[model samples]
Target: MSTTTAPEAAEAPAAPQLSHGLKQRHLSMIALGGVIGAGLFVGSGAGIAVAGPGIILAFVAAGLLVMLIMRMLGEMSAAHPASGSFSVHAEREIGPWAGLTTGWLYWVMIGVAVAVEATAAGAIMHSWVTGVPAFVWVGIFMAFFCATNLTAVKNFGEFEFWFAAIKITAIVAFLTLGVLGVTGVIGHAPGTANLTGRGGFLPHGGDGLITGLLPAVFAYGGLEAVTIAAAESDDPRRNVANAVRTAVWRIAIFYIGTMALAVTLVPWDDPDVVALGPYVTVLQLLNVPGAALAMKIVVLIALLSAMNANIYSASRMVYSLVTRGLGPRALAKVTGGVPRLSVLASCGFGFAAVLAGYIWPDTIFLWLLNSTGVAILVLWLFIGAAQLRMRRRVERENPDLLTVRMWAFPYLTWLAIAAVVALLALMTTSADNRAQLYAAGVLVTALGAVGLWHQRCTAATAATAQEPGRTP
Candidate 1:
């Protein structure tokens, strides 16, 4: 897992190489599927319980912020696509230190998330087949995805396509069924009772709406995967631009629209609602046939889809670092430009996290989860900063290359930056979120220190090498 480079291979990569194996269909589905995380299906219950039916407004606000961030990211990604993604942008617009810091932090975050997803999938399996140990199921899921990633880039795309398809279909079907039930078209649902009776939509007042914003912001975290996946796309510029523009609105529809139906069909304060997950609770009330089993299947697909997406993004990121001589040299080796070693390393970290979860649930295990809690904000902060600089440079020097410009130029971009700052500030208000903020602070600090040290070493080595030709 150490990123140390081998002596002989510790040189600049000869080329930035990767196969353009991801098809247009894969790119489209990745954008759609990225937003439909398993967390939304299960974890949203907690957010709803806190915010009440006013959660829809909270989602709208957060969704708008994300739309702006994507605009900034899309602007840069289209002009210059690389597997390193925001890291590559950071290096060009900010410095190598920023790129290395963001790249490794995000890379490690993705690896950790893989473990989290595997554990979630395993739990669902445990529910069905009560006899099997959850850890064993986690191992099988990890291995299955590992093999899927190790073989070929195209194979990864295919796997993700089907996985995403199932997730998307389930969400759509849920929305449809929710509407029917609320209207008494099918099943028993008290229309508007949940939304209206729930303290007139804001059980906890405006504070509840603000409270709902936290989960909504977090839920929108995975949309950045589209930009990352666009690098290996056939036409990076167009693909990135297309995905960003199209995915943003579609994601808004899926997230906000789904929340509206959920809150309408199921009251926010229903007993044991959060414990059962709102989807399951609603389906049970509506008396859907095999609702429990069907919903469980959907949840499993959601987890696996996330696993596939994160593993792909994490490996590509590490491969980017190695290609640029930022990590271990062995990871730079690519067969069919897939960087199989990098994938293995990424999955390895995930499995290691799984073991840590078993050994130290309260200590290291909790830290592992909290450490990357605010990474989405950190990434957006960098993206916003990088865009503020890169936008001017692109406009002045490479005007024609600016395919996907940030809307309203600096105005909206800066607005997005301010929103991220506000979200981070607000996150501290809750004890639960405060733990995440504190842990993320430690992580950013550690990465920053390492980045500075690496920068200094690179500088010193260059200075010494140049001294050999001195005339003195």
Candidate 2:
């Protein structure tokens, strides 16, 4: 009998393989778009409802956490860029299961978000044109974005650049107008009384501020999209590092600063804030004629912009998963450096979800949204874990490759995990969010089952081949 030992594998580095057509400006705007979504334009109402004038604190706290998460992600992404971003990091540092779970969860999240954004745009359009149904508008939006994403990657970046530019312009304009109004330069100079007068700034108490953090965190959900987009950008490492480094200041100015000016210009509990819309409320107070109408256009653009980005993200994520042999291989095919089949398949799902909502008219969208609620959090958790593992390996292997390291090393990584756990706990406390916790559990179980099944099949195949005295 001859005993053979397993041979040691060569330690050859894998070559990087991602298309790079995205320019610097496109990368910057993609980062900007990720931070500024329909959440800031429309969903801010929900946070305002809970926190009153203290929502500013909620935004600030959430922004800090998001900054920490982005930094960690940046460190890993800069060190080894991948189309799957953090998921690829998970596969390298943790295991294939981690990558599979995080990648599919994020893909589902983006798909559902596409439906949500389309429905939002549909609702707005239905308001203006009473004859058309909301689902019809959703259909139109799905088709529009489907075509956009099915084209080259540059086309998608171009569209998002304009979308983000509009949102950025609107926020800056809002802030400028706000300062003018507060200083008695533009309108009646509402002053800071709106902040102090209405329930003394902390109107709803600390609980309100805590509750407000939920939606505020949601507002920062899309910032990770920038890292994914970096996979297709020129100089992805530098672009991702720059974007993550500057994310904090941009979010502070756009979200916290804008919300501060909003509450300062008008009372948190003002009827206009609740009824007319936050942006419109401030504009109306400034006696800006046709301002409400103008903002309606801006909000529409915001919704469309979100829809476009969501479709692009979902397609690319699915493409990455397919290439890893976790999904259908057809989705991995790229023509003109674009995942055409994946784009079609993703948009098909979006269209189907929208149609189901239209036909059921009862619980489709709600279920979709709840199912994807904890997914972003799941992605962040994986990112934190992957970064923790990968950073150590990178240090051991190549200590000099530390251009964009996370601050505080293992401590900050653990802190991020703790924060994610707390957020999950908080989700259980709310009736509206409790469903998400349940959905997350079910998703985890499903992913585990699939992974185990795949492992068993692979093992069986190897065993059968070995029995036949053939190589597996």
Candidate 3:
């Protein structure tokens, strides 16, 4: 039986084939846009509220973790580029169950994010034109993206390029404004006094600093999308490495630098910090005319851009999973090098979530967010575990395949796993994030069961085929 299994494994096909459809520019811009999200534009206010001026520290801490995760993922992706990214790595390194779990979890994450982004865009649109209902705008946004994704990959790349450009331009403008404000070049110098003025740098003590990390960590969630996008690029390994290398610096500079300026320009404890968006607050402090209106436009663009990317990523991931035999095979087919049916199926759930949000107007969206939050956690955990296993396997199988490698190999991989565990443990202690911890536990258990079942089924099928002279 062992001898028979060996030949079957040896004859198994190489990983699923994907069209090298995306370009380097598309990937680079995706990386840039990944680091900029509604969180940086609107949601950083929550972090500022918790940690006072020490939110800078939170951004730095979270950025480091993101950098580490990207490095581990890059190593695996460079060696075996695939559309599924970490999900493919999980199957090769860990087991089939790991792939199933991480793939489905990530699919849920992208779906929920699409709904969240669409809702955010709708809110902004309704604010601008009270006569247009939010649900109408939501439907419009979904329909537009569904068409975009169903087109050829190059067209999708073109769309992402512009979408990412808008968000990147906004961040650059915000950073420039911050520098001028800090140097006292724009009106009176707000000075660094806001940092220590209200409650000192560490006003709320270590607890506040730790509490601030929750949102800061969440802000970096989208960066991994770049690695997945890299699989479809013409030069997968080179582009993935370049994007990962450059994106780390951009995230730190843009996210940490902007948050530092934000906390410095205005008192972290200011009442308006929570009410008005942080970026808008900075503009208002600079006394820029119509700054609030300008920021609303930027936020709307940011939300739309995120929605577009999430829809694309979700569809591509499902297509990849299906090709690997982990999902419905029909989804794996490509028409004009685009998975048309898969794109629609992926967006269908997102549209449903949006409709549910509109109907309930309250509870459903929050539950969706909670359920999907666990998915992000599961994804990082799998990336870390898969990298650890794959690194060793690569050394044994192909020692020359270390052109782009993780910094510390097994050590860094283990540390990343520890960091994921710590974050999960920390989530349990938070009133708001505790629900995510429970959800993550349920997901992990379900994945484990499914993996075991797949292994048994495969073994049984192999044994049955051997008993009869009936070849599979």
Candidate 4:
């Protein structure tokens, strides 16, 4: 079916105009920094504990998956850039239901991520200044980012660019230090002792490697922020294409390289790997001065960067949904070429989530986190599915739009889908992951049903208006 005349596409009003304020440099930095979230700093301990040195393999696998998903997403976004990104593509290719399901799922995921990132940053700051409360810090950080997002799109882009530059510089420096330490330049090289020893690198065996993949995959969650931001860039196609091309090296150096170094410099099973995190553990081993304080600052910056980016992406996504009639029309309003109302709505939800952590940490907050746990995977599935269908349609109707083509077309697309499905099925075997999958399934199903109902109602209304009128 031609997207130009699809009923689902026609049901929504025309997209609202947004500022093309994001520059090529901003897009590049966002893509580079998006992959290096606080999760890499704090959460990788579990993967290292479980997979040992083989955590490298787990990260590589996850990184490859992200790279593939980004390529597919970039292809679509380059062809037809929109704030909705994959959600818009899904609605055009699959139907209104797919769009609504994926859009809201992604929006909710980022909203929760905003709260999580804010809380993590607050905890770190409170540790530095014991007199100040963590909640107060969270409020301060929240307000600061919110103010940045509420203004022109350029402010948001500028904030993310510098935030990303900090993280990129830190990781590159860390990697350089790690290579030097491993090469016997700075210190005696362990020489595969960490990898060969400690249960011969396999440690807990294949099951451990599989278990490690869970965290490793989740660490790549925010990479899609670049594509979402691409729509507002000065040159959407060129910027998205460049960003997607660089994703390979970014993931290679920032994630895979760092994991290799962490396991190489220090024992993967080191208690401090879990106690102080992989970065701090490796830095302390290398005798870097003030390693602990240094990593704390870097990790704090990471959390803040993620908080800022997720807020921008989530607001744009909700704004896109409203423009498509999937959400409240009021949120579709744009002031100064920025979706001010949608920005507030996104920030408000994140703030409410922070309060939920205080009021009902175990019940409400935990549920919010878990329910959105599998959202990234779900969105990946939607992207794959939409790309498979949209690719064929675009080729038939407008071959010129295939600037950033998916490698190997249907084959790689199918492979990604299968990999995701296999992982989702495997997740059901684990008790904790099973709960998350169940909650996510519930959320997707409810949204899908609502979307379908709305689609049918809109069709009926359009039909009635087209019928012959007795008054006329």
- Give the per-residue lDDT of model 2 (tens digit) for 167-243: 89989998999888888898677666877886887888877887898888878888877888888888888888888
Clashes of each: 0, 0, 0, 0
Candidate 1 TM-score, true structure as reference: 0.94
Off by over 4 Å in 1: 1-16, 187-191, 467-472
Query: CA shift at 405, candidate 1, in angstroms?
Result: 1.1
- Runs in model 3 with CA error above 4 Å? 1-18, 361-364
lDDT of each: 0.84, 0.79, 0.80, 0.87
What lDDT score goes with residue 48 in model 4? Answer: 95
Give candidate 4's whole-model lDDT: 0.87
- Per-residue CA lDDT of model 3 for 281-399, tens digit only, reads 99899988888888788778778888888888888788777776677887776777677878999999899888777786557766667777756767888888877877877899896
lDDT for model 3, on a 0 to 1 scale?
A: 0.80
Worst 10 residues of 2 by lDDT: 1-10
lDDT for each residue of candidate 1 in 305-360, tens digit (9 for 90 to 100): 99989999999888888776678888988777678889999999999998988898
TM agreement with the true structure for every prediction? 0.94, 0.92, 0.94, 0.97
Report the poorest 10 consecutive residues by lDDT, candidate 3.
Answer: 1-10
Candidate of highest TM-score = 4
Task: Supply candidate 2's per-residue lDDT for 266.
Answer: 79
Better-scoring candidate (TM-score), 2 or 4: 4
Tens digits of per-residue lDDT for model 4 on 1-472?
2332255353244344788999999998888787688788878888899999999999889888888898899999899888889899899888877888899989888999899899999998898899999999999999999999999888888888898898888888899999999998988999999999979888999999999998998888787888899989998898898998987667666888989999998998799999899999988888999989988898999999989999999999999888888899999888888888999999999999999988999998888888899999999999999999889988998999999999998999999999999889889889999989888888888898998887778777767777887221
